[model samples]
Target: MGTGANCVQSPYHVTGSTWQTTSTHFRKQHTPHSLMFVCFSVGWVQGSTDFGVGFNLALDYGLASVYLENGTTVDIAKVEGGQVYKAAMRLNDNNIGMINGRTTYSRSEQINFKQSFLDNYIYSPNRLGGDGNGNNARSRALSLMLKALKTATESYLDSKISNAEVVVPFPASESYLHDLRQAVASVSLHMPMSAQPPTGIIAARAHGMYGKCFDDLDLQGHDKSMKNDPEQLILTIDYSRAALTALLVDEECGVFENRRVIHDTRLGLNGLHQLGSITATDLLETALRNITQLPLDDGNGAGLKYISNLVIIGESAGDPRLHDTLRRVLSEQLEPVTTVKSGFSPPIDPVFAASRGVAWDCWDRMNFQVNE
Candidate 1:
């Protein structure tokens, strides 16, 4: 998506099947490549205002390149391209004809068949504001998301991918999955049973910590470490216009077993700024406090332990002051001296972390899974 709207599509690397950090164990158990990776069939698709449709034209304007733009130019992505472009891109099953005076636009121009309704369309219905269309609006939004996915999959493979395994936010509910399935059906895309998108924080951790591919050079003095400790765990907090989510991951096991919370609130970066530093601090502190009580399994029938690290990300984390405040507050509150980390995905906003995580997941599913 875009940094302005606070969505990340993290960059990923595929070394056989394992995602992010690789290990000797995974390497040793090599299996024949799965057909899933045979033709780049598995992919991740995300929408965003920050990632505008990229169009590059030569000086002669003879050779033109056009495709869904990623988080390259923030200013361009933030700009609302146009109502026509947006509406047309928000693909629905119905036609959106315009009657201007006595003349009407052609069917091709009026047809709502391409999905590009920005990133907001995928949100739950309640997250949708009082646009007043209600169910119709929600249905249309989901349709657009599916359309966008189809278009992205087709582009990524450079061919039509009839079957795909899609990634969604972690802890996606049955209803959300059902909606996605319907969208896939609407677009004539087949979703495999095994294909699933990991939650937002895990994906971020893979790119930021494990893969070490996440770029955060802009976050001066940011605390990002590549150390992996089995007994140690990390907490990741994600902020966006859609919601606030957190999770804990075991470094050694590479498993995200606990979900801190998925607070459904429209309070985005703008909302945080509006709430001022103190209120935001209190709100964040409340969320982090919940982590202190989370049970930690040491795998030896032993009791829980303190989280070793805490990483904060999303568009809101861009504010150095906010990042610092979060770090300080969490440090003061966590049981053990939790090292706080703040960083964004470099070359792209930290927003792409989720998308990249899913892409890597698809690659892993296709190439790494041993049918033992």
Candidate 2:
């Protein structure tokens, strides 16, 4: 049931009871006591080479280290007396194999090492371009990240006791979650392991959109006339749609609640603004509260329970007032959510900015729904 390099192995078809047994086996065997954190940052290019300002946020945070399964012998040291062996380590540790017609080592030893390293470093298909063309640049990058995660988890487990946990950081958006899930599924399909599928890997936000900002009347206008005014609601949704799209394309695929946009519109002008501010403050507070509750072991434990690293990103960041408000909100809400100042630069280049903005406008015009 092993597929070659480019394809992932499909999950085995089993009876209902067998499926349950498999699931339980995976949970029991793969769950780690220590957490492994992996962070991913998404962004678009800016003007010419300037690229304006691309949103760069930590994608993973829970795991301590990532291990490459395959080990490359970089250097050969000579040990004198008890250990007097000296040799040179090569920089480019290419795959071990016969170069010319000479037999470098015995067939048995060569075969054994080749099998071992192959098992350690999972092979990934590399294609040109990041435009999401099948297994293109984006997929390659994802594969590399997954391989690193797999290697890291195995290495950590080898040196430590069982029951250690692993954490993976990602955007909280549905799209991001989908991408990550796909990446993990891809890895599980390719990698061969004795233990069941790895579990206990928590996803934390490295950068997130402030739902309050999109909900506020100051930013997103609302009407006070009708009870459930469709016109006013439409305007608010449009504004939110624009803002969210701007942030996503410009701010490294930041996560925010689409429901908040609908809620803000339903509340009307004054109500929306007040609620937005309150929600923003509450989000910050909640983050801080969770930070206080982190387990006292290694830093990994904190990532497992709560987001330890924070990167704020958006188009509103250009405005001094909005930027200050966001900083204050984070300070008040989540004490542990570290605000890394990215200055006044825009996350995406100007060229893409307008396109992304237009995309938002189109989506809003069509009345896109979160469920959709």
Top TM-score hit: 1
Whole-model Cα lDDT of every candidate shown, in order? 0.37, 0.22
Please provide TM-scores, in order, for all candidate models, with all chains considered together: 0.52, 0.22
Alpha-carbon lDDT of model 1? 0.37
lDDT of 2 by residue, 255-334 (tens): 11110111111122222244567675454333323223322222133322223334323222243433454455334334
Candidate 1 on 244-310: residue-level lDDT in tens?
5455544443423332333323234544566777887676565556544545555567745566666
Off by over 4 Å in 2: 1-135, 159-182, 189-324, 327-372
Going through the candidates in the order shown, the clash numbers are 14, 36
- Highest lDDT, which number? 1
Model 1 worst lDDT run, 10 consecutive residues: 55-64
Cα RMSD for candidates in order: 16.1, 25.5
